[model samples]
Target: MKNPFRLPRRASLSRPWRWLVPLLLVLLFLAVLIWLPWQARQMEANERQEQLIADTLWVEQTLRFELARSEEALAVLGADLVSKPPTPEQLQARLNQMFKNGHELRRVLWLGADGAVLAHHGLELPPAGLAKVGRETLEMARLTRAGRYTEPYGASAHAPGMVDYYLPLFKRGEYAGSLVASYSLKVLLDETVPWWFAQDNDLALLDRDDHPIAERADGGPGRGIYTHRRALDLPGSSIVLATDSVKGTPRLLPNLLVGSVIVLALGLLLSLMTLWRHISRTLAAEAALRQQMAFRTAMENSLLTGLRARDLEGRVTYVNKAFCQMVGLSAEELVGKKPPMPYWAPEAMKDYEERFAGVLAGTITPQFETVFQRSDGVRVPVLVFEAPLVDSRGRQTGWMSSILDITDRKRA
Candidate 1:
């Protein structure tokens, strides 16, 4: 009673900031981890695109360089023939020069305007004489307005290999007998393109007619060159890159570890708080914690549900059994991989990508309904919820997506 009336001491000083500080710090850390990875992934994709652009230029430049050399060789040969039609001996001497220009002997021989063997080189087994075959080859040459760069043609005994080159004889005023050279597509793929540069790359050489003459693919969807319906002044070509559905990172341990840390911390804090509470209550708390751990483990081990994590760039970095099963892709095929955007057919895929990007940019969060094609060629409907991974400071880093298989729902 003496103390009760003594004027309540100043209200026990309490600062909420103490708890807020640690909470903020952890939140900030989580945010940073999420955002940085997404940003880094975006940058990596840019680098890839840049590499592709550079490779495209390299292909064109290399072709131009080789074509120029071919033109020059034809010019010199034309001059030699103009002064004097090639005799068998002269043609034989010319074969030496052709070989020097990197033309294999068996693969490349020569034919004269009269369609007779003028000069020939390396030939263990040559094809039928292409003498006067100038017209057959000329049929393609006539279409090229560039004066150089011939069209794709079938096998020629003189040039048994498939080839793309310039026949510049037309430059000497009249079609002064044609000079043709062809290249082996296999050699170009296996040798000409460096291994590192060709990794995950698809390349194709389209003909003047815009048909794919040669193509190569590295496990992804192959590239194609489409032709135009109407005959026009000029034709066009395009390059397309395709990738399969992305794989997700392993979620079990990470989720468990994160959950464990929180549970452990809470348990310890509670034990300390109830140090004077009944021993019975403390035992109950311990039991509850164990139960939670068991539940979490069971959920993680469950194979019926699959999960995956994707960054803002649409790359799948984490995948679980259920996700892999649903997609019909092995974890090896999907994880740390990105699905090609601008979906092949469904506009929904493209819209989903855009919406995800917007959420990453902190514009707005969006739910995505899209169709994903599985490895076995089945298309499954999916619902994706996108939200930012943020830190204590509320800074956006990357995104966390929860995906639910809606294939059954769609069917229903």
Candidate 2:
């Protein structure tokens, strides 16, 4: 009889190609899930550092501007004091005029030829020993005789909370005793320090000696002005400002284990899906084959026969209808079950296993025949043919086998 079993006529689809597509997609999905979040956190930290640098530069500029303005106002007042040594009434008038100009001078001092407090404004005339302390203020004013802004002097007898600006007065280019303007730190804060209050910042003006002579802020020791070197010349005072730091979100390892598991799950799912599609199409094709095979069986089924189809593992995957009928078992009962060694003809088991192993190893193609035993203890002959089952990449996976019952030819 012509061979009843045959290969599918046209390549309906490449089964191996179908399975590989999903495997690659699953790997791609895992790569994206892990990489995106880590990059975002690195970007946020860099932005915070830049903003802190900008705020510090703003404070340093404001301090320099206010100091320059104070020195200029003191120079104008100093010129008048030395040009005229006036009556007591005239000295009081000049002091009142300076105060009315909205400057924060707490005391005005006039030094004599021998550095004595010859006349002063805004101080009680102290007794002899007490009034002698104004000599230090005269010594500071002596430095400005050459005409430049003098540094701050610590509080003298009459004024304790103050910084001084001294200027030498001249008439006809002749040397004269100096005029000194004493500034109240409180008035300086009231005029210039309010502008720094926004953005939670505190500003302090310190003397060259690092004593805090003026402050526009209250509370907290956030005071480390020297920590930022740009504020160094603003001397004695430290400026500190802070904002609530942006809280970082918790980082979960979204892509580490989760990505790997997801990829694996997808791979398994794709594999299963491919397997299901494969099995489904194979079953449909097999059903069509069964119809054609049924007619051949009807012509040949009268004599009892044995059939077995094995994979490369020597486990049976299919059985013909005639063989199923002879064993009195359904095809499901025989599939995936191993054939008994004793039922096989002598020496067939070794040959079958070796051939199946060769097919699995890709060392040989598979197609052969051997005797088989039926459920009724009948020795019957069968023919089996196998082909290498592989992926599109041509890697061998398993084998597909078909069996034909050949008992009638043997019996006849």
Candidate 3:
């Protein structure tokens, strides 16, 4: 029997809104958890590439500025030699001072208009007048009336690798002589690129044909992943400044945070699983309860005995199919009707009231006979067995009466 005293539990499994909404939320949260870090990693890779490009450009500019400074000094020295001839001692002093400031220069030669060396300053001077490159650039400068660089030459017994800057000297617009400053490409990279920068990148000098003349890889050879190139932009021949970073892709947003997010997502999934399991059990139990209620209703409806139930205050509460037929009223009309019930015979109203008062006072007669008036006003005799109604909690909350029609026995 249904427990009249028990309140209904609203959390029926049939209503899916509660767990369904949370499940969708958890799935959406997991998708973002996956996408955010990958996006962060892509952004970090782009930033690292941009930084490499910017740094390569700066190094290129720095190298060119240093080279320009040396060329300007050589041009001034050539002009001064034409205007005021310095003694050997004074000329050596000036060269020492210039070399102290700039270390890229390996040799400096002052020549007369006749191509005879007037003065020379360096660690090693070539036995021959000049290499083919130096001769060509010297002639090129004499014609152009401007300073220029020689095509790069590799290491000989005298130097690591070299290029020569030729500054043409003139007096009264006459070709007087030439000033040549030889540059060591290796020394240029060493002096121009800082230690900190070299520690992370490998620097190389490439000729017009992309042939590498000299390189510095203080950290290590590059992986060729992140690289940048800038032209040296010099005269006589073009040289490209290529930077290959030793560093690979930058790390994504930290491992700890990413791991934490993964762990939390797993935890949430676990929690959802547990919640789903509990809800499943609740649904199964509710399903079983509903099936039992259905079976009980079927069994009660099949009985020949009419069943009636009332609350503690003597108010009618439940009437099965048999009870409705016996009282000659529909269950809906008889279920909530109080004493002075429509089914009570008019002549037996006094007895019905006394018995209802006894039921409310916790005193019920076990067996009794009564007359009930049918809906057509025909009187019928019936036997009734009354007992205290106990709920599922085992507490008596009302009275239950079973009625059996005795008209056939009376006729026999």
Candidate 4:
């Protein structure tokens, strides 16, 4: 009989790709884990820069609007001076009203063409203080004969960092004098910078030389990590509005959310791979067991020896095909049959019964000769080998026998 438990010769033991695919997937997840945070930070930086530019432009436009309104006020004053020059008391009253209405303006002055101060409000500058106007400012006023702003100047006892807006006055197209409006940089910034913007950033007004004329008082100097500056479109002045972030830029929350998702996805993938591997191993083991059982069944079916099994109670429990043919009986008729069986020869029945009793009591010889009466009444000689049928725990549960026909050998 063939050995039923032999393994197939060509079966492979190694499966490289099984582990390699999971390794590659892990690598891909790690790449995403590293790359996604950086991408999110880049996007955040871009958005911050755009916001800075927008804020700078807004400051510039706001400053320009305030200056334009101031200039218009000065133009109206200039027109009134050209039409009907007011008494000192009347002029002082008008200047006080103008000062109350214009919170950013430090002082308003009416100067004679000879550069002498005729009247002023909001500051008690001495008559000699009118000479503080620079040569460039005087020259520009003389040439343009139009309203224009002057270069920024350092803070004085009366005003903190100042710039002067001059509207050249004319009587019948003849250059008459100048109506001057001096703006306090501190006051201008306090009014121009929006409250919302001041909450998150430090804004400063800079002069042509990049000197800060005014800055927000709410915080100390900014870190300058995110800074933006833009020029204000004011005539005869090179003023810049600059802004800096007061605190570090915040990280995007979505990046954290995305990172968590990536981690979860990686875990899910690894878990699925593990489950698949376990299932694959289970299936492979099941297939191998099924194949082994099939091989054993085939080997048993092809055997020429008659095989039989008897329970501890001495009743026939199993018989192979050869056993049925040898006795001239079908397996259904032989199985479950007790001793004094149909195939037992009448003359040898007592000897067979004694041997069976000895076998059940574990004292019979392992090999012996026996005789059975066939269906045609012929006595067949046989040689039988007996062994214990053991269960998985190695406890004997029954007796097994392999019988070989020895009638021909005896006849020869």
Q: Identify the leading candidate in terms of TM-score.
A: 3
lDDT of 4 by residue, 185-286 (tens): 888888878887887778888887787887784766678888998888788888888899776765644556776877787787778778877877876886
Give TM per candidate. Answer: 0.42, 0.42, 0.77, 0.68
Please list the residue runs of candidate 3 whose C-alpha ends up more than 4 Å from where it truly belongs after superposition.
Answer: 1-31, 155-160, 208-212, 251-253, 266-302, 309-317, 329-381, 385-401
Q: How many residue pairs clash in each candidate?
A: 22, 2, 0, 0
TM-score of 1: 0.42
Q: Which of the predicted structures, 3 or 4, would earn the higher TM-score when compared with the native?
A: 3
Work out candidate 2's RMSD over C-alphas: 16.4
RMSD of each: 36.9, 16.4, 4.8, 6.8
Estimate every model's Cα lDDT from 0 to 1: 0.51, 0.54, 0.85, 0.80
Worst 10 residues of 1 by lDDT: 226-235
Candidate 3, residues 1-412, lDDT tens digits: the string is 3334323666676467876888899989998888788888888878878988999889889988998998888878887899998899999999998898899887899989999989989956657768887888889999999988887877444545677888999999999999989887888999999998898898898877777778889999987878888988888868888988887765654689797987899899999899889888987877778778777888888998998888898888888888777767887787677778888898999999898888867897899999999998989899999988887899998888899999999999
Pairs with backbone N, CA or C atoms under 3 Å apart (clashes), candidate 3: none
Candidate order, lDDT descending: 3, 4, 2, 1
Model 3 lDDT on a 0 to 1 scale: 0.85
Q: Which stretches of candidate 4 lie over 4 Å from their true place?
A: 1-26, 126-133, 155-160, 217-220, 252-256, 265-412
Which predicted model would earn the best lDDT?
3
Better of 1 and 4 by TM-score: 4
Whole-model lDDT, model 4: 0.80
Q: State the weakest 10-residue window (summed lDDT) of model 3.
A: 1-10
